[model samples]
Target chain A: MSSRNRIESVAHQTVQKSGLKNLSFRTLGAEVGVKSSSVHYHFPEKSDLGGALIQRYRQSLATTLAEIDDASPNAYDAIKLFSKLFTQECSEGKICFAGMLAAEVEFLNESNREGLQAIFNMYHTWLLDQLNQAGDELKIDLPTPTVAHLLLASLEGALLIDRAHPTNDRLSSVNILIDSWFGKIN
Target chain B: MSSRNRIESVAHQTVQKSGLKNLSFRTLGAEVGVKSSSVHYHFPEKSDLGGALIQRYRQSLATTLAEIDDASPNAYDAIKLFSKLFTQECSEGKICFAGMLAAEVEFLNESNREGLQAIFNMYHTWLLDQLNQAGDELKIDLPTPTVAHLLLASLEGALLIDRAHPTNDRLSSVNILIDSWFGKIN
Candidate 1:
C-alpha cells in the first residue's frame, strides 16, 4: 500500500480499539512504522486524518453491504446475513464506525456526522427490504421503520453490554436475541 | 466541599464534555481551583480518580432515582418522573457514565467495567418496576422486561445522537417516543 493508505489503515485500528476521541497522529505513525512527521506529511492535522478515516470507514461499510446476496436468499437468510455481517464487524473490532460515531454524535464533525447518518440509512434500507420480503414469504406483520430502529439500537446495545462484561457466549446470545425477535413475531 | 468531592465535580464536566478517555487530573485540578499536587494527594493515580468519579456518579443516580415518586399520581407519571430525572442528569454534565463506558468497553479496566454494569442494573431494576406497574394499571400484555430494555437502549442511543446533532428537540422527542410506546401497548 501507498504511504497515505498505510497511514489510514493504521489510524483505523487506533480509532477502533481506542476511540476517535483518543486518536493521535503520532501514535498512528508509530503503528505504521513511520515517524509522526512523516504521517503529518500526508495529513496535516488530526481533523484531516479523522475526516479521511471516517470516509474510508463509510466506504468499507458500503462495500460490505454490497456484497450481501439480498436477491438470492429468502428473507430469513437475508436478515440473518445482514445481522451476521454486523456482528462479525463488531467482533473483529469495536463497532461500525458510523454506529460508534452516532453514539457520540455530539462530538462528531459535520462531515463525520453526515457520513454516519448516511451509513445507518443504507443499513436501514437493506433491513427494510429484507423484512418486506420476509413478510411476503411468511405472511407476517413485520414491524415498521421504528421497529427496525429499535432492533438496530438493541443490537448495538447488546454488543456494548457483551464486550463490557466479556463473556465468550454473550456475542452469540446477542445474535440469538435479535434473530429470535424476528422469528417470534413472524 | 472536600478536595476529593471538588475534583469529582470538575472531572464530571470534563468527562461528560470531552469523554472519560480524555479525562486528566491536571485539567480537573485546574477546573476545581486546586493545585495538581493536591489533587494527587487525594487521588494518587488515574484509576483511583476514575473509581472515585464512578462512585460519585452512582451516588447521584441513586439519589435521583430515590427522589422519583414510585407511588406517584399514576404509573405514567412515575415513568415520566424517572425519564425526566435521566434527562436532568445528562444535562447537568454527568451524562450516563455507563453509556460512555459502553462505547469504549474494549479499553476499560475491570473495576470500570463492573461499575458500568452495576449502574445499568440499577437503572434496569427501576425500569422493570415502572413497567410492571404500568402493565397492571393499563391492563396490557406488553413484555415488561424486554420493553424496558428496549426503552433504556433507545434512550441511551438517542442521547448520543442528540449530542452529536446538538438539539434539545431530540431530547424532547425521546421522551415522547418512550411515552408513546408504553401508551400504545399498555
Candidate 2:
C-alpha cells in the first residue's frame, strides 16, 4: 500500500476497535512505523484525515452495495446481503465504522461531519430504493422511508448491543426482522 | 449538586454531546468551573470518573423505569414511556448516555466496561419482563428475548442515526416499530 492508503487502513482499524475518540496521529504513527510529523505530512489536520477516511469508506460501501445488487436476484436477498456486512463486522469484534462515527458526530469537524452524513444518506437512499422496488411486487405495510430508517437503525443498534454482550445473535435477529418484514409484505 | 455530582453531570453531557472519546479532565474542569486537578481530586483516574458516570446514569434509568412501571397501564404504554426518555434526550441534541458509552466500550477500562454492560443488562431485563408480561395476555410472534433485543437495539441505533442527520423522525420510526410489535401481539 502507498503511505496514504497505509494511513487510512490503520485509521480505519483504530476507529473500528476503539472509536473516533481513540484515534490520534500519535497512535497512527506508532502503528504505521512513522513519526507523528510524517503522519501529518500526509494529512495536515485530523479532520482532513477523517474526511479522507470517510470518503474512502463511502466509496467502498457503494461498491459493495452495487455488487450485492448485481449478485442478488430479489429484494429480500439484497437486504440479507447488505445486513451480512454489518454481521461480518460484529463477528470480527468491531462495530461498523459508520456506526462508530455516528456516535461521535458532534465531535467531528464540519468536513468530517458532512462526509458521515453523505454516507448515511447513501445507505438510506439505497435501502429506500430496495424497499420501493420490493413494495411494487409485494405488499409493504409501512412507508418506504420508515422501513429504510428502521432497517438502518436496527442493524446498527444490534451491532452495538451484540458487541457489548457478545451473544452472537445479531445475524439471527437481523434474519428474524427481515422475515417478519416479508411476512408483512403480502 | 455536590462537587462530585457536578463533575459527573458535566462528564455525562460531554459524552453525550461529543462522545466518551472527546471527554477529558480539562474539558470537565472547564465546564464545571474547576481546575483539572480539582476534577482529578473527585476521581483519581479517568476510568474512575467513567465508572461513576455510568453508575449515576444507571441509577437515574432505574428510577425512571420504576416510575414508568408505576404510571403505565400496559405493555404498549410502558414501551412508549421508555422510548420517550430517549426522545427527550434527542430533543436536547444528545445521544443516550449508555448508547454513547457503548460505542467507545473497547477504550474503557474493565470497571467502566462492566458498568456499561450492567446498564445494558438492566435495559434488556426490564424490556424482557415487559414483553413477557404482554406476551402472556396477547399473541407475541417472536420470542420475548428477541423482541427485547430488537427494541433496545433499534432505539439506541435510532438515536445515533438521528443525531447524525437530525431528521426529527426518530420518534416516529420508534412508534412504528412498537405499533408493529403490538400488531403482532394481537
Candidate 3:
C-alpha cells in the first residue's frame, strides 16, 4: 500500500482499538513507519484524516452490502449478514468504527461530522431497500424506513451492550430477536 | 453540593460534552470554582472521577426506574419513560455519560471499567424485571434477558444514530419500534 493508504489503514485500526479521541497523527505515523510530518503531508489536519477515514469506510460498507445483496438468498439472510459484520468487529474487541465516532460526534469537526452522517444515511438507505425487497418477497408488512431504522439501531445498540458486558451473547440475541420479529409477521 | 459532589458533577458534564479524553482536572476545577489540587484531593485520578460519575449515574438511574415503576401503568409505559430519559439527554446535545464512556472502555482504568459495567448490568436487570412483569401481566412470552439486551442496545444505538443525523426522529422511532414489538405479543 502507498503511504496514504497505510496511514488510513493504521488509523482505522487505532480508532477501533481505542477511539477517535485517542487517534493522533504521531501514533499513526509510528504504526505506518512514517514521520508525523509525512502523515500530515497526506492529510493536513486530524479532521481531514477523519473525513477521509469515514469516506473510505462508506465505500467499504457499500462494497460489502453489494456483495451481501448478490450472495444472500433472502432478506433474513441479508440482515443476518449485516449483524455478523458488527459481531465480527466486537469479537475482535472493537466497536463499529462509525458507532465509536458517533459517540464522539459533538467533538468532531464539520468535515468529519458530514462524513459520519453520510455513512449512517447510506446504511439507513441500504437497509430500507433490503427491507422493502424482503417485505415484498415474503408477503409481509415490513414498515419500510421505520423498520429499517429499528434494525440499524438494534444492531448498533447490541454491539454497545456487548462491549460493556461481553458474555451476554448480544449479537446472537439480536439475530434471534430479529428472527422472532419476522416469525411474528409470517 | 459538597466539593466532591461538585467536582463529580462537573466532570460528568465535561465527559458528556467532549468525551472522557477531553475531560481534565483543571477544566473541571475551573467549572466548579476550585483549584486543580483541591479537585484531586476529592478524586485523585481521572478514573476515580469517572468511576464516581458512573456510580452517581447508576444511582440516578435507579431512582428514575423506581419512580417509573411507581408511576407507569404498565410495562409499555415504563419502557417509553425509560426511552424518554435518553431522548431528553440527546435533545440537550449530550449522549449518555455511560454510553460515551463505553466507547472508550479500553483506555479506562479498572475502576472506571467496573463502574461502567455495573451501570449497564443494572439497566439490564431492571429492564429484564420490567419485561418479565409485563409478560406476566399480558400473558406474553418474554425471552428473558435477550430482549432486555435488545431494548437497551436499540435505545443506545438510536441515540448514537440520532447524534449523527439530528434531523431524524430516532428517539420516537425507537419508542414506536419497541411499542410495536410489545403490540405483537399483545
Which pairs of residues collide in model 3? A157-B153
Stretches of candidate 2 off by over 4 Å are: A136-140, A184-186, B136-140, B184-186
When sorted by DockQ, best at the front, the candidate numbers are 3, 2, 1
* DockQ scores for all predicted structures: 0.32, 0.59, 0.67
Of candidates 2 and 1, the better by DockQ: 2
DockQ of 1: 0.32
Looking at candidate 2, what is the lDDT of residue B79? Answer: 86
Better of 2 and 3 by DockQ: 3
Give the winner by DockQ: 3
Model 3 alpha-carbon miss at residue A83, Å: 1.5
Off by over 4 Å in 3: A136-142, A184-186, B136-142, B184-186
Lowest lDDT block of 10, candidate 1 chain B: B135-144
> Candidate 3 chain B, which ten residues in sequence have the lowest lDDT sum?
B135-144
Candidate 1 segments exceeding 4 Å error = A69-77, A102-108, A124-143, A167-186, B73-80, B92-95, B129-145, B166-186
lDDT of 3 at B37: 96
Q: lDDT by residue for model 2 over B49-123, one digit each (tens)?
A: 888888888999899899999998999889888988767865566888888887877778788888888998999
